[model samples]
Target chain A: MALPDQITFASSPALSRNVVDALRAMIASGAVGEGEHLKESELADALGVSRGPIREAFQQLENEGFIELRRHRGAFVTTLRRRDIEEVYSLRIALEQLAMERAATRITPAILARMNEVLDAMQHVSPDAPASEAVALDLDFHDLVYEAADHDRLMRSWRYIRSQVSFFLQVRNRSHPDFVSVGYAEHRQIRDVLVAGDPGRRPTRSSTTSGDALPAPRRSRERPGLIAASGRRDPA
Target chain B: MALPDQITFASSPALSRNVVDALRAMIASGAVGEGEHLKESELADALGVSRGPIREAFQQLENEGFIELRRHRGAFVTTLRRRDIEEVYSLRIALEQLAMERAATRITPAILARMNEVLDAMQHVSPDAPASEAVALDLDFHDLVYEAADHDRLMRSWRYIRSQVSFFLQVRNRSHPDFVSVGYAEHRQIRDVLVAGDPGRRPTRSSTTSGDALPAPRRSRERPGLIAASGRRDPA
Candidate 1:
């Protein structure tokens, strides 16, 4: 059976991988709340697959740190902590900063156009739109940078943490209703920096603007400042 | 049944993850040569597990880029190319360099001692010892850095690319027989720098020394210089 349109899994004949993608999206989008128990039968029913693929996906998800499988108790969504946010952001900053550096040097006119296209799409998103919309466009902008960098393994590493980043962005979207406009300005600054073509000038651009690591829960305001200067803008 | 002692999996009760470790070890160690077909039944028999776990492991391995699942043709180990070496090394340098930087700042005396212990163990290995010996200690040295970084997601990113790095290091071990001793010196330099307590000074230390990456198979000689100053060593 074909995976539904909304499930953006890379096309593969392996039912389990598709199931992994579907379930991962559900978890990342918060359709399945953190710490919520996952029942194989229920997931199977929702995804229109069998328990076999669901079980297989559980193993992969456990390995990916997306969920925890308790012995005999089944799977539970891994709860995000302040540390998880900090860890993800710190690594994302390192990787994305490197990518931006490389992308700045190697970026082509076509890639810039594509990035502008994504930014234009971001311009259309409503401040009160679903978090997924803002999150999707935000990731697309970074994805273009990774693409321009053209380092296969580097992009692979970005993918490893992307879903988690998406989850955080979702939180940022809800927490900051003005994220659409604020995020737009931040992304435009990044694009303008790239267009300026001085990779060496702002080598630590992302991390510098991101402030220190997301040190505590109260400091969650500073978490999604990877590209956005959201830390300076009060959510309240 | 318990996984064998040689299998250093993280003591998970999940049989499939154990199988992933076993199969991953085989491929990374070159026991299952690149492009070799993996028979589920044969692997199941060899590992004394059911075909169920073998099948499940194949899915996970494919996701990890260790093997390719050809529709109806079973699974085959991913063939490493010069591009693979470059891609892996580029990202590894970015991630490991960041790890080393963070580790230098936040590292404890105990972690430094543990790193010293691994270096001492590497010192004892014969220059012509099995590639696996050199690879394990090489990874252990970097693993200590990731552990010292103490960022959960950063370490997770390290593990994501680790097996592939191991595979490349295995290639380095076989291609450069003197890798054991040379690798020891390189690791020692890194340790000394970390011990010097100046993360800010040598921020680009690893990449500056790794050269322009393993650009071609002819340049395979320069591939594993991630830590090793093999670029200047002259393999011939």
Candidate 2:
């Protein structure tokens, strides 16, 4: 049977959303360098869209902490300094701890079942897959934990920080071995703690250092190499 | 001794910082409403600046999550929903817990002395003083606690959430008398707990349904009224 035209159509047109998605991908892909200017005409031309929608997309992106807009100068990608990175990860730890504790009480059987599926997938994926795949799976596992916490605001904040850190994670994953194994073990421990249904489980002060304690990369001038490795043309 | 001209004169003009500050005030002051268009030309005219500086300011603001830019459409003030409020507060709870727990070990004598002063001030504030003054002092007290936690990242995240909630607190404070008193007492208790120097002291699980439970205000059509109450605003 042929479907009605209304049934076949999506509720909203994709132009605005597509622009947002494209811009986000560009930023996330590291095509846009930190503090690089965003020329409206060039971006609009590249995206094959009028300046109006592109401007709107920029506003949305700004709210999401992806880009910075200047009054008259123009927009630019943000630079996350060591201090900024530290602040973000610290917040993440605090929020993750809260989510773990809340999941102890709020995690349902269904949520746990879905989490188990993700864990199984992680275990089964060939280690030969590009490291990015493992990174994505790691993000998915954390996202599931946030979902189980059932706090909408925490989830949004988490998304903001996650986006900011995604590039850093890419660099870190490339440099670190056993990153996946260590992260997976932590996830399993978190899940076990949640399943124990003890909301009182406070995060022990094991190490104040960041995951694996790799020193933060020094600011680099090898823009071309970084851009190529990160798979994005420099927005600058 | 008289200061030298070099010392007295501004060595470096802080145009970018000033612009960021001005734009933040406009947003925080309700001079700009959520979802209202932040036309670059209009803002430039209002701030007595060229489009160049305004563009820079927008970039900074975007990084701070204060405004959203749409392609061609222009930037708009962010409109946070009820769910955003809830998520922010939940994150706040987690961050506060982390800060409080760590503060137990890291609270310096200076910090402790400052806290004692603030608590003493809170106890003796004339009921006749403007509510704004009281609120400002209260915020300062909390800020001190955050500092004592010695985690810059956690404090930064907390600052962002607190700014978002400031608008709501203004309204909440007007109707709730015990809000100030109860909060004062809680602050005292938290201080005492930290003073015990036990980093392992878990936050008591107070009943969630008590009178102290945060009041969930109904969404209203009125513009946020307390935007201008504080001159210091940090977007993130």
Candidate 3:
């Protein structure tokens, strides 16, 4: 099978980052199976780099929860066995909601235009096209919202959170190409909210609870906020 | 000034983790100034350990965004400046709200009681108590919910998000002892919500926006949720 596209290894300066991305892309594309033990020497030989960069890449991946390093034992790709996809979806909602809120407060016409630009780009990436295109647009659309929020720590935190889903999303999209269109509609919904402008200054009915931004998840099929249907937990 | 207590150095076994906590405590206590370069060798000597552990500890801190590793230069503690506390508060709202929601669904009586146990322990930790006591309880209260949520990645991501506020929280408590009370009350509010149980299953007004669970930031002062006022942005 062909390697997953659009995950071109980044060049120079940060050599370990390239290895990290390449390895992550491999994991995403199912080039490497889950629960596989990743030997440093094997990866070093495969990537044709020294073990130092391989070790560093392993360190970076371990930090991101992509891999685990046991004492004396080498690194192994992390298994998300007990952690259900539902929890991941919920986190995406929480984080993206915060990002949307901040983006609403800080977003300008130019930024809104940029999101629409991505949306326009999304239309051209047909469902029959490579899932990477879908993944890239999906990542870009959500990323712009966080980027517009202008919070360094939030953005940094999102990057780590996104890593967990990057491969999973590609797999999901590849299998269900419908996610491309479905996800675009979700992105448009977010765009509509931001286009409505800063809700931070708008007065709303007072409530004493947190999560005031989201109504309770009354019905499961298609919750209204933050790409809900994209990842609803099928009744377990 | 005496190093603000509660940050004792840990002995071997997990030396790097111990170093991470000790260094974090130092940062929290202002022993290490923000933007100061941290020499691994100096830190090794000072902590009575070798450079290997110090390097590993520094890597950990850098991953948490506490320190920056320059290309040629060594590590520097990141200045939380330019980082608006308002953004930080909102992030806490997003993360903790989701954690609270999940914890509510699966929280055993055992965990709830454990939180109450911490709360009970907290009272003896008077406002007059070392700010560290308040800090520890504050950390414990929020941490239990994430832990109870039982999602490893969520918990891991929260830990990283938390490092940004930890030093700020300790310093905030040191200076504003009143926040200790303010924060406790807020934690109690969340406890009440969880005790009420199943807000996720409960019906509420439906909304399309991402933050439908959260009401608009009507006032900058305390609003309901997890500890609100403790981290409220000072009107600069």
Candidate 4:
């Protein structure tokens, strides 16, 4: 599978970043399964890098919550409990709403034009297109909003969360077809709202709480297990 | 220094987490300076552990964005650029505003009362009474708000950002008189609004075109060079 352009080599001053990106993609793409142990020697050999870079990359990945390192056992890809997923999406809604509010005014005509181009491209792509492609498009659209907000820190946080959520999307996309259209529509509406420069107004109620606003479950599918497990419970 | 009581440590499942917490405290308290390389062997030696747990802790810290690891150079505390601080605060406003909105419904009298108790504690302690104490109270108030919002993911993100901001606050606080009263008043107003459940009904102003509301500079000190160099030219 072709990797998304966004994951291309960043001129990060640190070499370990290159390793981090490689490993992150592997994990996000499900090549590295959830809870799979990450062995330094194996990864180092596979990537043709030294144990130093592998260890450094592991350090970076662990911080991003992509992996968990056990003291003596070693590192493993992180498993998100259902509540963890909900909490992530909920936070995404809050940040995206804020970005949309800021992007409304700041989105230049050029940015809007690019967004429209993405929408048009998405329209023609079959809903059956690889889930990664769909997820990449979704990210590109949101990245534009984040860029417009002019907040680097927010963008970084969003990037981290998006990486985690993309894992879940990979699973969900295998079964769901209509999310592409619904997601595209939400993007279009959000774009329209920004272009119109309406900051104070909430988007029409049709926008679902989930970023995608997927339709209700059909045929006892993956819906309940995923959504129920997405957020946190009260300690009580 | 007394660690906050909110975090309960369980010894059974995750030793890496314990190491992560210990290292985080070290970084947060300024025991580890920015740009200082973290050597696995050295840290292990200091903590009376092996390289395994230290390496595990490094992974956790890296994911949290607290440190950056270079291939052969080892790990160093992540440095914030001026833009990084601005982005952090901007995101804080967005996240905090959402928390405030959610807290409007979830906030209980008991939480409000606890917040008031903390505020009262601040009132009794003069601003001159140790910077650490004042900062503790400040954190307590914000923590209460996060608790009221009842979102664990948001709280975790908030805590991460707050820790980063604290580094800058250390520099800023030295120049400004402790504006404890003003800070408390703002919290009070926010609490009052939440208690009243005022929907903040003012139509969001045209989000697209409006510029940020720049607060009058409370301190005339020049922006830190560290941040100024890193600040992105905002497209807006």
Candidate 5:
């Protein structure tokens, strides 16, 4: 699976961030399952690095909530249970709502054009394309909104959950491969609203309080569907 | 200055969290000024630890946005510019608004009583109390609201900016030592609204769209003043 070049640690001084990104990409691509113990020696042998960098990478991953290092035991991949996903979704909704509200007026024409390009990229992904591809594009699309919003701390808050959000998107992509195309239409609606540039009329608030609610069944299918459907400023 | 024992690193399984807490307290208490270079050897010498723990603490501190680790250079304390303060305040206002709205119905009598206790404690804080004392109580007060909200990721998001928020509060306390009393009244108002417990009528939305705006003059005075006064559920 292709990894994002920008997935970096804040403390990049004199450390091998490559190990960090490689492990993150491995986890994000489902190469390693959740709750699996990552042996330092084994990972060092596998990744062709020494134990020191592996340990450092583990520390970085733990910092990013990607892994848990148990005392006396080795590092274990974090399992995002249903409750964790719900927490991530609810928080993401609040953050994106704020981002969209702020971006409504601040969004530049250039950013809108860039968002159109991301949608176009999604359109090019074939049905057999890797789910990670769709996931990356999906994140890229929202990343643009945060960029346009131009609030640094707001962007940081989004990044704080971006990893979990990526996992959630992976679940969604596996559940619905056709979601990419559907997402195209959903994002188009949001883009049109951004193009309209109506801060007062922006549909930042969800009409129903259940906006954060996830359906009991088909967890992946219905959870993001709410945000993709009614959570944004739907001009309709 | 007394530090909160809860300030910890995610990778605390082996490393000494005392170093992280000590450094954070030093930073938050303004013992270490902004943009000041932190020599690892000196810190290790002063804190009576080896350089290894100090390095580990630097990585953790950088992750929490307390300091910046420059490549080829050492660590430096993060300077919260006016822009950074505005960003922190605006994002915080949004997060707290969401927390209070959700906390309205979910807040238990036990929690309200606890909040009342916090306020009572605030009322007793003498004028000459250490600035960090007020800072800790101020954070403790908001920490309860997040707990009442019962959203894990939301609380994590709060913790993300918490250090800067600490710096911001320290700035406020120094500027207005009497803010503890003023804050008592303000929090009492919010507590009354929570006691009212009407989500339908909760004043979650700002009456004026300028809820996030910081008054240009006397930023330390007016920026938090907005959130402390008009940003929450102000029923009156």
Candidate 6:
């Protein structure tokens, strides 16, 4: 009944998918330290599964850039060198800023209310709360932004980078106690900017541009590059 | 010597990586059309390899979002749905803008000159020239920006999306004649911006910031977020 650390993947059809999720959680929670080689034999033994599933799991995560598998050597939990952090955060700012700019124009009042609720929860979070709790709240808040932006590709890319962001933070043991309050303020600013910029503020303007006439030129900034082209227009 | 359609590993040290590269090339070039079913037996037969490497390579490409693997049904080449194009382009705009904004500040003269060489190649590429040639030149120009930005993770993410970008363009058969001239102009504009924005423009201002007081805060825009936190300062 009490099989701690054993991966009991209930109801999931794919064994490898469940294993990947379990292993990713373990890495994210610091259960398995970074730079530690993941031995198939040991993991297979501990999780009470065959080496086949473990190998497949390794392949899956490796593809996602979460782990690096060496030819002769075993898999290593990817440790974030300082550069990885800087690169990931730089991408994050570009994506989240663009998401906010778009979300601001399209976000519904219901979404804003939900975002405010997240901000309230963040404000009350204790200074000493676990970093995972804070990271979850932070990701959830931004997820709402991406969702509101209504860009499928953008959302997919964000989810991939989201795992990497949490991975590095966990490895470096870098989340500090004072960050809760600071993050709260930063998120609050984001929420305010979204509300202030929402075109739904004037519902008629949004309706004019809401329908399917302008599918290709989704963002105003990107239009100049392609629109100016003499060709490349869809006849539709 | 002409083993048409067969994947020859030859002298490559890593089989799976080479297979992944070859297969990715096939997909990107439209040699393997969208929605095509890739069977391990068939692929391994054609490539003159065993099923093992083919399976691993499929997994690798799947991880990169190039193909979809279904249970018992095998892998299917992902068709570039309209939204995928929109998604890739949206992410591209966010990424290129951030890259240009950063590259403008730090790009070196030699790098700008190399990018100029790419622009020259693009300008000469005839409208009848293959889309592949134009796409390669275009990527090279942007690659220079990513390199100048000097962010490894950013570059990695860019390359992943770059494949999908090329994949869709090739599939739709939509790289019109006017695009050659239009793309040439766009790339030139980008090159000009990079040269103008190099922080190295005013050598004295750059030199003052260069000698090691700051380590992590690479961009002028992102400093306010993490730097204000009480802990988590970069030891570098």
TM-score of each: 0.78, 0.61, 0.77, 0.67, 0.78, 0.71
lDDT of 2 by residue, B70-145 (tens): 5567677777655445565566667777787778888999999999898888888776666655666667777887
Give the C-alpha miss distance for residue B61 in model 4, angstroms.
Answer: 8.2
Tens digits of per-residue lDDT for model 1, B1-236:
22243433466588887998888877654576666778887778777778898888898888777887776788877765555666776677678767877888888999999999999998899866788888788888888989988877678777878887776666655556767777777778778878877656336644222421222245535443333322211112
User: Per-residue CA lDDT of candidate 5, range B1-236, in tens?
Assistant: 22232433455345546788888878876787667789887877676667777887888788777888776688987765556666777787678767877788789888888998999998888878887787787788788888898887788788877777776676666666676566666677777777777544325444211211222334445443322322211113
lDDT of 3 by residue, B81-181 (tens): 42335555567666766676677777888888999988887666676777777767877877888888777667877787576656556655554667656
DockQ of each model against the real complex?
0.51, 0.33, 0.44, 0.43, 0.48, 0.40
The iRMS of model 1 comes to 2.3
The better candidate by TM-score, 1 or 2, is 1
Highest DockQ, which number? 1
Clashing pairs in 1: none
Better of 4 and 6 by TM-score: 6
Which CAPRI tier for candidate 3?
acceptable
Poorest stretch of ten by lDDT in candidate 2 chain B: B1-10
- Interface RMSD for each predicted structure: 2.3, 5.2, 1.8, 3.6, 2.4, 2.2
True contacts kept of each: 0.76, 0.72, 0.55, 0.79, 0.69, 0.79
Candidate 4 backbone overlaps, count: 17
Worst 10 residues of 2 chain A by lDDT: A1-10
User: After superposing candidate 3, which stretches have Cα over 4 Å from the reference?
Assistant: A1-11, A198-236, B1-10, B48-51, B180-185, B199-236
Q: Model 1, which residues run further than 4 Å from truth?
A: A1-14, A25-31, A45-48, A70-73, A196-198, A207-236, B1-14, B29-33, B45-48, B70-74, B207-236
- Model 1 chain B weakest 10-residue run by lDDT: B227-236
Under the 3 Å rule for N, CA and C atoms, how many clashes does model 5 have? 1
lDDT of 6 by residue, B47-106 (tens): 778888788888878756788878778888765444454567557766766676678777
Q: On a 0 to 1 TM-score scale, where does candidate 5 land against the true structure?
A: 0.78
